[model samples]
Target chain A: MSRKLLLWLPFALVFVLFAVFWLGLKNPDDRIIASNMVGKPLPEFSARAAMPDRPGVTSADFTDGKPRLLNVFASWCVPCVREVPVLLRMQQQGVEIVGVAVHDSSPALATFLAQNGNPYDRIGLDEGGRAQIEFGSSGVPETFVVDGKGRIVHQHIGVVTEQDVPQLLGMLGKAQ
Target chain B: MRRLAALALLIAAPLPAQAQDYAEVALPDPAQEAQASRLMDTIRCVVCQGQPISGSNADLAGDMRRIVRERIAAGDTPDEVRAWLISKYGDWVSFKPQVKPATLPLWLIPLVALVLGIWLVSRRLRRHH
Candidate 1:
């Protein structure tokens, strides 16, 4: 608390704040989709089945002891249409994908799946999109890599292009 | 001619009517509706960088508005509704962050700056007096 120390304190604080800003700008990815729910247990959710024959998806589905992708999408989402093939490719590699169709009509969703080929292991319909909010999704086509123990390891916001597949796989590989 | 050009520009730039999805025209109880609207003003649109859900016409913001109204109409207080959103979307969703251990600095820095400014001003006033 000396006068000399006090004189230097403001500059030191400004320097620290500048460094923090610089570091944040250095890695833009972390700030792109900030979520407090990352690295935490996936919240519980249940929604009606999008398909008639398949059972609806629930939080209990993830407890089956396998790592999987919980994807929030809608038939109305153009980006969701674009990502269909990538999801299918992931499925080909034995990735388990659970789908939650948000703010969509069941008939329209069925038609979308029929046209694009369904890649989901199980599908759920989020009528009000309340379930999507629980997943901390900013918008449609957000994906969470849930580990075997049901912890959300990583989330990919926005369109999941082909390039993101490997990075997502790497996250799943790193998760216990 | 200038007014006509301005009108043309206005008509040419189609409004974002489609983006808002009409937001369901159903009106709820007047008191509850006002409460929900106020709450929406306080809640930030998670998808939007810094805008409140009430101001955003984004689809997700529309969904947030619906949920806010639904919860409030179902007898939840505004604080309870906000707490529920925070549970799902975290403190970032609320423009007014609750006073908690982690947010103490965010809540106090402005106050500290204000107090310092006032003290400096008062010291200058005393010298002048």
Candidate 2:
């Protein structure tokens, strides 16, 4: 190799390293821990009813020939409260939503629903958070779009804003 | 001064009692418990982001620790337990990356850098001599 080319190699290497780091840092999905359960069948588990009035959620509920949104939420999560109105709006559009109330009790969820207008068709109380973990959910307020066969078609982290409703609807439409 | 001390006690009293749910108990077999603890150190706490479950105080981490102990007590090898967690949380949950095609670059980059450094140093030294 030429002396001039060799001299420039170190600078080129530094520039390449900088570009790689910059691209990694700029990636929007960098902070999001992608779930391994997407495209897989829902893990078999049963959760008791979060509130007496609602039915308990089970894996069998999703296996029926009807796609639905499985919302993992908690009464204590502030973002879950923010997400309620959007979920209610989705429910208005005839989107069936099942819920896993992570580490929450009946009274707390009952109060939450009364305040925010219940959107869940069925709400299961995941008192130990085991069901949430089995679903590959890291935290509260994550939503999974499950198809008729019970495969997780999409996993959405964080509160679903008004802007996200159309995208979710699209995913749900495709899921069917 | 007495009122301030009373207020401090009230605040501090609940701190230790809060959210130490599943991790409070260890496996009955000391050998199994030791294996569980070792596995816990290698598993990242998803909620805490990079801290091991053994070091994290997060409720989820506590649950993970409990799962580890239970699995170990049931005769699961540490590798099997790690695989179970990785299956649920993805490879991100494991601090120790598995040797696979996707991770080849991660495993090789350091070796590549070392080789390049040695070649460069040897070239420079030879020229000086």
C-alpha lDDT score of every prediction, in listed order:
0.82, 0.88
**Model 1: per-residue Cα lDDT over B45-122, one tens digit each:** 876657888888787788888878777878999999999888767787888879989989998998997898698679
Q: Summing lDDT over every window of 10 consecutive residues in candidate 1 chain B, give the lowest-scoring window.
A: B19-28
Q: How well does candidate 1 score on lDDT at residue A38?
A: 81
- In model 2, which residue pairs have backbone atoms overlapping below 3 Å? none
Residue range A1-176, candidate 2, lDDT tens digits: 69889878988998999999899768633356778999899999899987778899999999887899999999999989999999999999999999999888888888999999999999998866788888989997899999989999999999999999999999888886
What are the per-model numbers of colliding residue pairs?
0, 0
Q: Please write out the lDDT profile of model 1 over residues A24-51, one tens digit for every residue.
A: 7786522354556788888888988888
Model 2 segments beyond 4 Å from truth?
A1-30, B1-22, B112-129
Q: Quote each prediction's TM-score.
A: 0.73, 0.81
Per-candidate interface DockQ score: 0.29, 0.42
